[model samples]
Target: MMYFAPYIDASGLHIPSYTDVRDQLLSDARSIFGQDIYLESDSQDYQWISVVANIVYDSFLTSQAVYNARGPSTAIGSALDIIVKINGIKRLPAAYSTCYVTLTGSVGTIITGGVVADINGYEWTLTTPISIGSSGQATALATCKSPGPITANVGEINKITTPTFGWTAVTNPGTAVTGAYAETDAQLRSRQAISTAQSSQTVLEGVKGAIAAVSGVQRSVVYENDKNVTDANGLPPHSISAVVEGGSDDAIAQAIYNKKGLGCYTNGNVPVQITDLYGVAAVIRFSRPAYVDIDVTINLKQLSGYTTQTTTDIKSAIVAFINSLTIGDSLTLSSLWGAALSANSVPNKPTFSITGVTAARHGQPLGTIDIAIAYNEVTRGNVANIVVNVS
Candidate 1:
């Protein structure tokens, strides 16, 4: 039922729409047999023509999909090797988070693996054995029940439910880091389509493009700390820094490994280290994005006629514009106002004021919201975030 272009190219030789094909066939039948054919009525001849036209129209659509490179042939993205070869980049699977699970027991007591803990009803299982020493406690690496960005929060998992022999208590020592979801079909298609234009060559932009193809990655920026350039972040000469967000440590590391040049230093606060195909070690790091929240107040003097849906649509348009911003982007009042008035079916234009603009770090517990955000922040807004007053 989805609508597609009814023509294949500028010549419009292909008839992709059933309605258009049916109408044309009906017209042609009338011209061939005169008024006796009665093609527009519900005659047996008309029924047969309709069925045949439907089948032909479907064929046109399928042929169009194949010619447009959007057919089922491209859906074989499940094969990782095929995806890498076709898209010129490897798609990463879901990523897991590693954290220390604490266990309390008598001195010298051995805390066994598979001991479970409840973090707000989510389970975390220990993998390595931990021996209680002078501290009468132990910590071992544990993995989340499932992987994804949901486990990336700090201090979100506090409660421990599973009891272990000779252990008094159990809890996760810190927030789970570097969990991520699997790649989706739409996401894969988008990555593949974009890479098709550049061929995924081994260039700076190509490396960044490859990283962007990784699942759970929101945005990435690649930088080269070249010679004669005094690096502010204290990188070795001729090093590369791959700053990324919303990605697991393992996935991001592999993405960098697949694309980075040999002998280049991988810089940043890498949660984990990854070795490239040639056994070259590189530290892949993540830079979390800050979220900026904008509070908009609009006063509309209804001129002529405007529907209530128009007001609702205006709010959605404004919020959509705000959310479209990416990392290292800034927000301005003028841009926000323009977005509000750009909504379709909105019948009125009114003056507005941005009463407040505030931003905060994603996980900052106690921080003031500033009126403006820095370049490394992304904006978040919704219909609920905008207030409209109509008279």
Candidate 2:
């Protein structure tokens, strides 16, 4: 006599299968009506029993889902949204890519609400009311019109869309600070875990947590040098260096100022002035991670079910894995094999066998050796640079 019931034990919630539910319902029917009663598959009584069993199974599934939603790690969608509120954090929305473009034109020419286009045809809106300097040039921050991971490399944004008088040309001198899509559930969950360290007794951990909590901040690493002299990494004594990606400069500076220990010196490339409640101003500094472009070459021997799409997927996967690496994380050539193979979602059968893998810095000769990333540098990979040789 099998009984169908959901139960909670040390292993957590467990629900019986639909087959068990159906069998139990039939058993109950026979116990009430004699065992000799007709309950064939086509019988009205059997159909009614199956209906009740299905409804009970559905209710059990719903109950199980609700139970799992109570924990942040297993929650998803709206459930995850509600759970993260307990940590005083919300999902980071998509952001626009930004770049500094130098406008070369007549001096004192004011361009308000000017627009420019990248070589890829993406439109970027310049900061308003920019007056050309006496050197016949003005540098202004331009934000992409469309949000999310838009990129414009140096010399790419050269088309002036809003053609103001004396505005002869436009171009970005450096790579755009790429934007991001809406934070995924996994990303949010990880951030929530880091945010818990905000109240840590260790000041360094607390400072790191506070910076991680800043809105629009994608990734951050904190390094501290507590000795009486400068350390090997060039950090000043009793100083901290934060290598951060994303977020506004002012917001990151404020977060660091609020949580860092008193008398601690900060070291980095970007500096912002923060005014304390006492009306005293102090300079806080942090580094924006420098990006290193990596080129990869993958040779593959095609297996069953391999297609042109598989090659594309393999390239995309390799690029994604490279870009997801944190600052200062080394790029191991062996790891790329797994990244390339992950493109095959099917179990047991693989789509391709990687014959060889090689990588190098952009414009450098590809090799099998691991690429060393410096403390303030992050590796970036473009699908265009990932060459997949498929047979």
Q: Which window of 10 residues has the lowest lDDT sum in candidate 2?
A: 1-10
Q: Candidate 2's residue-wise lDDT over 1-391, tens digit each?
A: 3564678999889898888999988988899998998999999999999999999999998998999999888888899999999988998888888999999999999999999999878899999999999999999999999876666778989999998998899999999988866888988888888888899999999888898899878878999999999888778899999999988899999999999998999999999999999999999999999888899999989998999999889987887788778788999999999999899979579988989999999899999999999888988876767898887
Report the C-alpha displacement of residue 321, candidate 2, in angstroms: 1.9
In candidate 1, how many clashes are counted?
0
**Cα lDDT computed for each candidate against the true fold:** 0.61, 0.90
Best by lDDT: 2
lDDT of 1 by residue, 24-99 (tens): 7777788888867666546888899889888988888667545544332354444433545555555656766667
> Candidate 2: how many backbone clashes?
0
Per-candidate TM-score against the hidden true structure? 0.53, 0.79
